[model samples]
Target: MLKIFKKYYGYQWLAAFMLGLVLPFIGKLLSVSGLHKVIWFYLIINGLYTLYLGYSVRKRGLSPLILFALPAVFSGISTLLLHLVSHQYGFYFGLMYIVLSLFTFFGDTRDDPDENQIPVENGFRDLKSETKNDGQVSVDGNLKV
Candidate 1:
């Protein structure tokens, strides 16, 4: 499951964002107290997780600074907004999660293998040894193979 965990690290961020965005509503529906505390805890955990992933990718020469920064900033802003806005904006928060997810997906380049590392032999190959220089092979006399 570790492989799945690594692959969906971005999704984890989305889920955390969703949880933080909805917890207050859920708590209100259930008449539960301390919703803010729960949401804050969730945001804190997810924010730290994002930072960890960013650090890991950065260590591998992929700059995940923006990925980390945006979420960290959003977490603070959204938490504050959730408190100030009486009307729940969970849907908008979800939209923000999707936007963040897209950014994370597009921003990451570590998932792709280096093009320079691909072996030449594994690329286009000539059927005949003589025409290897031309990158095309000639057949029989009339066929120009």
Candidate 2:
């Protein structure tokens, strides 16, 4: 489980959202009972998380595609703020969440370790070794004869 979490931990919000979607009536109940404050707090946390996600993705050098996460961060903020006052902006938040989810689902954010692998045997293999003729010139004019 820890391994899976490390691999796909960024998708935790999606899992939470799915669970919330399945149990929306509880959220509605909380909202009606003046407990939206708690929900607002959670939304703030979500906002921070979305912001972190955006920044982390951008820091990972996944730019251009990383731009997609920015709106999600802003929308997470917008949702928290708007949910504090009214529910009219819920649709916008939903749209932004969908966008974030799509980005999370499809974006290739993983860095390839192979891309950074250094060759064990580069061309400069014998730089310290003295050649047979240090001052001799070759046909290609390589040495200082």
Candidate 3:
């Protein structure tokens, strides 16, 4: 479960978005209003998630570009779904979430520093040794933790 969480560490808000979509239908079975009161709850949860995402990305020295357009695209899809279903079900929350996500992501403008890329090697050998110009395998002298 933690592995899944780490793999999708930044996409937890999409779960909230999906739950918001399902809430109206779930309410019908529970004898509750079909999402009339849940919009605020949805926004609050996603807003908190957005705040954490913003803060963590800043602290981790990540590129804003990595987060750029992610919330926009998801919120855009949510907004489009809202347009399709809101009139039929009568709850509108997508616009405000989009605005909040836009504010959080757009305010971060720091460029990512250049990443040091490790050269890829494909071989059955367990040791990390590169072939020298003289066609002899030599161990990499540099050790990294």
Candidate 4:
């Protein structure tokens, strides 16, 4: 599964774009009575798409981070601004998606296994030492050679 994801993860965004284009009609069809219902459906679909985009990008180490993160950040802010202007609560779900994306972008370093790793030194010692000679301690609390 990881191998497949590593190879074809790029396709996920394109699929998401297509899915987004089709979501409004599906929402409209699902909501036969109320505009609010349709908007709510749209919000859920859009939020899921944003989450999918973030996850896909986070999973792809070879891909450029800016390509996904910039659009997501801008889209999230725009969605919030749009909701503010239009006074629609359904669109507020976009903010949640944005927060999810930000978390994935910053927190998910699992894509690159070595990124979080630190090499160990064979005989490393802390520079700050409490060693004293004749009750005279170093001013910086480190042993002076």
Among these predictions, the greatest lDDT belongs to: 4
- Residue 49 in model 1: shift from native, Å? 7.6
Order of candidate numbers by lDDT, starting with the best: 4, 1, 3, 2
lDDT of 1 at 139: 65
Candidate 3 per-residue lDDT, tens place, 4-77, comes to 75565445445444444444334444655435434443545545655565555665655554443334433454
Model 2 is weakest, by summed lDDT over 10 consecutive residues, at: 16-25
Note each model's CA RMSD in angstroms: 9.9, 9.4, 11.6, 9.8
Q: Tens-digit lDDT track for model 4 on 50-134? A: 6656665666553644335423432443334333112253334445556655666566566666767555674334445666543
Candidate 1 lDDT trough over 10 residues, lowest sum: 84-93
Off by over 4 Å in 1: 1-26, 29-87, 114-145
TM-score of 2: 0.35
Rank ordering of all candidates by TM-score, starting from the highest: 4, 3, 2, 1
Task: Assess candidate 4 and give its lDDT.
Answer: 0.49
Q: Given candidate 1, what's the lDDT at residue 54?
A: 52
TM-score of each: 0.34, 0.35, 0.38, 0.43
Q: What local distance difference test score does each model get?
A: 0.48, 0.46, 0.47, 0.49
Give one digit per residue, the lDDT tens place, for model 1 in 33-97.
Answer: 45553455334444445545454554454444435433443355454665522324433443454
List, residue by residue over 1-145, the lDDT tens digit for candidate 2.
8677556544544534433332233455565443453355335544445555554544454443433343443344334543332345445544554455455444554554455655767655646655776585679988775
